[model samples]
Target: MTAPTPIVLLHAFPLDHRMWDEVAAGLARTHEVLAPDLPVALGEPLPEPALEHAADAVAGAIRATGPGPAVVVGLSMGGYVALALLERHPELVAALALVDTKSTADTPEAAAKRRQVADAVQEAGSVDPVRAMPDVLLGETTRSARPDVVERVTAWIGEQDPARVSWAQRAMAARPDRTDVLRAFDGPVTVVVGDEDSVTGTDAAEHMVAAVEQALLVVVPRVGHLSAVEDADAVRSALADLAQRVHDPVA
Candidate 1:
């Protein structure tokens, strides 16, 4: 039998590959999984973590995953990088799974907010703004019932390097609309989101699904922005389903 295609996992802002630990572990039994720690999470200096730069880096990592097309899975900021990779190197991707992310560019007001956060990080020498993100990161159900998940997310945000956080903020602020990229992709696409995700909710997922001819949308109930961590099983199932589609296009 042929080996399964590799699954390249791109992580979100201020978080490392650890965000996909459980999902990767579950998928690893039957697939090759590549979850690289993005530069922003490595405490490395990034003058500007532009999506193009990050996408190039991710492409390099995907190329290193052996000689075959791979399924690309990304969340939040990772999704932006994924779309960039799709635009720049579609040959490397066999399928795509985008979780809790949007294809729209930041509005002027939203861009200003991101720049302000970047500025604050530079001024305070810490990711203090992210430290207060639990309310925005988790759903009310997850916050009130899943203390462990909330704690894990808070810790992840707290551990982000101040400079790297600033770089990510700037990079995200500069991202462009990628709906065209999505519409052009011919491979299988899976758009997953948390029902309670206020950051990029059901509407965003729906929009993405509409843009991709082969896209399916999965909504994880009682979760929020960090759906993978909030509901790893559901997220993993979505990825596994996409992996099947990637490996067997006729199936």
Candidate 2:
């Protein structure tokens, strides 16, 4: 049998490759998976968080996996980097899965907020911008019942490198609207969002799903921005279906 296509897993902001650990482990049973730490979150010297630079870094990782395109799965900021990857290296993507993310650029107000957060991180040397994020990142059900999930999210936010967090903020602020890029992609696309996600929500996912010619929208119930962590089974199943589509495009 031909080898399954590689799957490149991109993580959300203020978090490292660990966010995808559970999902990746499950997927690894039948596929070659590469979960890369985005440049800023790697705990090394912070590079200016340019979206293109992050894309380039991920592209390099993908290339190292071997020849041919790979399925790219990105969440939130990782979704932005995934779009950037599609922009920078279209031929390297076999399929695309965007979770809890949008294809639009940040609004001016949002950009300003990002700048403010970046400045605060720079001055305080902390990831305080995400201090109260569990409420925003998790849904009512997850928050009320999954204390383990909530604690892990909080700990992940706390362990972030401050300088890298600031860089990630600036990089996100610089991303452009990628709806046009989606419109141009001919490969399969999957847009997944939590029904209760306050960050990007259903409308955002719908917009991208509508833009892509061969795209499907999946709204995971009782979850918020972090669907993969909050509802790993649903996400893992969605990704498995997407991978099947990649292998059998006619189906």
Best by lDDT: 2
Candidate 2 at residue 222, lDDT?
A: 93
**How far does residue 21 in candidate 1 sit from its true spot (Å)?**
0.8
Q: What is the alpha-carbon lDDT for the whole of candidate 2?
A: 0.89
True lDDT of residue 155, candidate 1: 92
Instruction: List where candidate 2 sits over 4 angstroms from the true fold.
Output: 40-45
On residues 1-251, what C-alpha lDDT tens digit does candidate 2 reach at each position?
88999988898887888888889989999999998877633436656668888888888888888988999999999999999999999999999999999999999999999999999999998888667788888888899999999999999999988887888899999889999998999999999999989999999999998898779889999999999998888998899889989979866
Candidate 2: lDDT of 14?
77
Residue range 24-112, candidate 1, lDDT tens digits = 99999999899987752333446455878878888888787777879999899899989999999999989999999999899999999
Whole-model lDDT, model 1: 0.88
Q: Would you estimate the TM-scores of all the predictions? A: 0.95, 0.96
What does the lDDT read for residue 218 in candidate 2? 90
- Model 2 residue pairs with clashes: none
